[model samples]
Target: MPPRSGSRAKSTGTDFRAVEPAPLILLKGSEDYVATRALDRVKAELKSRHPELEYTRLDVSAATPGELSTLASPSLFGEPRLILAEDLAQMNDTFLGEALQFLEEPADADVTLIFRHSGGNRGKKLLDALGAKAVVVDCAPVKSDNDKLDFLRQEFRAAARTIHPDAARALVAAAGSTLSDLGSAAQQLMRDITGDITAEEVDKYFGGRVEASAFKVADAAFEGRTEAATRLYRHAVATGVSPVAITAALARKGRQIAALVDHRGPQNQLASALGLPPWQLRQAAETARRWSPRAAADAVEAVAQADAEVKGLSRAPEYAVEKAIGRVSASING
Candidate 1:
């Protein structure tokens, strides 16, 4: 799957299969196995329900716009199939315009067509048009520690293994959040350990402790710890974090801080306003303690400037990002 572009952009994962008796579904998110795993489980259930199902995978990346029109055709063999178009985002405008027309009246056959577009502006219009008829979901990057842990549990289940709770936490923190990496780490752990893997076994093979700690970048910046934040920002950037990505992180944090001090009503209401779960209120409260209205206001301005810089309005994305970090850190600390 491709990566999501811009805020609010949804990611597409694997194809979706129907329940015993239901319409086709869509699970949108990152290249994470969660969505892919959902597809797998759906297929598993579909098999027992309807054994005659057929599956088709198509890579639509290099195909010309005219070629895309061919996807609407029925399968050569008369069988139920799940068709996945892997690179729908790369499809040309001509293809997208044509797609908009077909989405309105899709073929109601035994086949289900799933278009997996990681995401971007390339086919925004067509995708949005299919929103009501088709499921248009955003597969943003994972942020919650719990979500990552749940992903780890799913991994263990796939291996026909069970891990201790503490061990799962260790794997999440030690392995980082990417699905492919987590799966590899889980397999190695399962293979290396003869029996059910315990938390103790995790410490021996995993090695991402320091890397995941880079999340400290946001913690320090929001708390106004300029020194720690600056050092961590440099380290994260040196580790290959893009200037644009770093700036986006700041933008996300800034929005979070702004939501905290939204004094329009009881602070509890702020969670929904921020699109964060209720548990985030604890962290928001703590982070808000260090933030003044003036500081949050300034941080917002800084992110706006950085966005322009990284987006090509300015020649120096790195310098612009550094400036935003400094401004936010100082404001939070001051």
Candidate 2:
């Protein structure tokens, strides 16, 4: 994946604004947020160039080659056209031949072709062919903790403001690692606070919900930190995170730990099996060591009971979750 653009504008405050439009643009890889942002940039630039530009969007995965060829062909009105071919990986062999043949000759000067492909080898032949003629921009996922931390810092910095490291960490912990979610959280935090931000300010803005996030609460509970887990649970509930989401997180974490026990593979393979990032796998492995296989199974059963109780069986959902947290904590200790 290509490195994200470095320059920032005062108004847009993003690298996308600096990108010039390309004839055959390939947004490669699986980072949805990044790819979407890049796509927006291209559209914005094109709109700026020709206010009345005609845009023809086609999902190549579904559209026939004849349809795509006609759309990409020169328009009768001579108006500039912006052609978007989404899901390039699903482009059939027939369309691939037509597209490659079209690229062989010079295209209409007024036309721009943007191909969006989520990562995979499904259409490697097409991707390689386009590489010779396309301006490829990588949109790979952010995998490491440090990279995510950098993203948080850059987001704040782009706004001509700064966030304290502890505050940033707390925000990431609560918001989860996905870029779209984190971006939304950052916007909320900025809207709710002014001047330099601190951990206390973050906690206050989120109404003490940072520690109460499902992942944090479950992490504490799974390691037998009953006091911390209970406190977080109360705060999370008070802040309006649904009880269902809370219990669901608990059940998922418990299941991950239980599954880790039965797996006998390298950490990377184990992480892949569990659909977790490497760092998260390490955390789950550490937590798994605190429990016997029987205890882990018991915790999973407790979580299932909590899930049911919170939904309907119990009148007091809060107390049911609290009791489940205690049960799981004891299991970890055992």
Candidate 3:
């Protein structure tokens, strides 16, 4: 986890572009997107160095004993080889025994072995051995919104394009939480939109997507824009947005405001303590300033009622959500 060359790159995060071809490289984690990207980077690097590189992909689960040794052994053509051994987490005993043996005396400099293990304790011994010898690339899950935003930013930066923060946020909200979807959406925007991407452009492209609409309603409600919140909530329902989704967004916003309402620490410390990104914490703090403790409590109750109603407690889910929006807005105003 060395810092990448660029100033914008994170020191602790893996930069696939900076990954060099090693005798043993481990792409470890359950995040397929990251592992795939890291593997691609390694392949690209090796391909650049040796245009006639012999690439072989082996399914470790199906591989036989001594198969790795046979592949890693020098070929007749003398071409440098890159062996990608995948599914190490489900590796067979034959492959495991041979892999451990192979590690004792690794392949020649001309042959590189790349292993992909997608979590679990399937082959802890081999994993431990590989951990000691391999150049490990973490493919951990990107779960939080903050991490997703960072990913979107990286995607834009890598393309030599810039995205406005609001634009990034809008894209994340609209694209949902899937990394692949976000990547695809970002790629589409980068290819279609000229210059720096704006919030207007993201809305123009994905305005019909209802995922962001719920959050938009919550935002307006928290800001005391009752009319705007009501309008947005109605429009979201019209566009087929789920009432549960709206309630979930409102609950999340309520929690953010509640967390910040009585917080009495430095902003940075609070952000870290709450596992919130600084930007999100700052936004929550701004909204929290207008909210008394009682108002915050009332908003929580309102969101809970809406949550229950949306999940089969009320006959008219739409009305329940609208009522919650009104309560939130009232709390904000008072």
Candidate 4:
């Protein structure tokens, strides 16, 4: 029998960290770092109080409605249980109905249910309904460099370690900006070197991730380092770097080169006009020397196309980015 919708309580807010686990939890978003940490915290808290936990992981895609009904039903012994339901988008109609029905009634206080969702168009109806009642945790993906740096700061602080600000940026540069990689790097650094970490230490130890920043990739592409830039692009993408970020970097670099190529004035005046720092203007001038004005225009056009492709206009975003890299490299070298 379906339970009444208004019979059970709704969620107070989206602050999952403070809230005790309600009967339903909707862990939504693409940021694995935030979501995973929250899930771990919940499990740790639950297990600490109840040493013997009845945890069940559900596969809604394959499990029949009958199986789900049996699993979520009140146990005879009334043991505290933790139910984890993943890939909500893949559930069949019958299983979806059964799951929604279960949420209508208040579960035994001891039973906690967590639903893991990787954000997409699928399961919109279920998500909208669950948002009202489920303790919603937003694990939205962190795409910008600054946000990733902030994440590193918090992670390091959590371990009672104070990392220098420059060191945090250095870590992002060296570790490819992904939360998991950054977290691992933080632990490794803290373990190997006692006390506060510095940028020099990050460069010395974890230099691999830093070796391929978006700007560096753009520099290589514009400087006609075809092999090098292409390799860096692949590494960045694999390490969860956003394609949009890469395109933005390329566009910025292209504009700098264009400005340098067209400007005819005192160095300071040109720098002011282009809004580039002295060091950056010098670097752009050097790169611009290698490419003709026509080539610079071509590079700019390529970046624009790549931008469109990555924003969902093209089916293959990664390839589109790579192609843009190749075009820019070829133009500069031409």
The residue-by-residue lDDT of candidate 4 on 3-101, one tens digit each, is 433334454335334445567788888777767777788888888888787889899887785876677677888777888888777877776887777
Per-residue CA lDDT of model 2 for 1-334, tens digit only, reads 2311321122222243244576677777777887787788888888998998888887776667577668867878888888888887787776777776666655667777878888668767777766655777667677554456677787788788788765665565556447787777788888877767654455455524444576678888898999999888888878745555567668767877898877777889877665567887887888887778899889889988987886689998778888999999988776
lDDT of 3 by residue, 1-334 (tens): 3321111212233565467787888888888888888888888988999999999999888987678889999888889999999988778999999887787762477888889888899989988777766778877788665677788888888888999765676676677457777787898999997878866567678755754387789889998999999999988778656666677678767887888888887989977665566887788789899999899999999999988887678999889999999999999787
> For every model shown, what is its TM-score relative to the native structure?
0.46, 0.57, 0.64, 0.59
Worst 10 residues of 3 by lDDT: 3-12
List residue ranges in candidate 2 displaced over 4 A.
1-18, 191-194, 207-211, 214-334
- TM-score ranking of the models: 3, 4, 2, 1
Off by over 4 Å in 3: 1-13, 215-334
lDDT of each: 0.62, 0.72, 0.80, 0.76
Residue 20 alpha-carbon offset, candidate 4, angstroms:
4.6
> How far is 37's C-alpha from truth in model 2 (Å)?
1.1
The residue pairs found clashing in candidate 4 are 173-210, 174-209, 174-210
What residue pairs clash in candidate 3, if any at all? none
Clashes (backbone N, CA, C under 3 Å), per candidate, total: 8, 0, 0, 3
Stretches of candidate 4 off by over 4 Å are 1-20, 191-194, 209-334
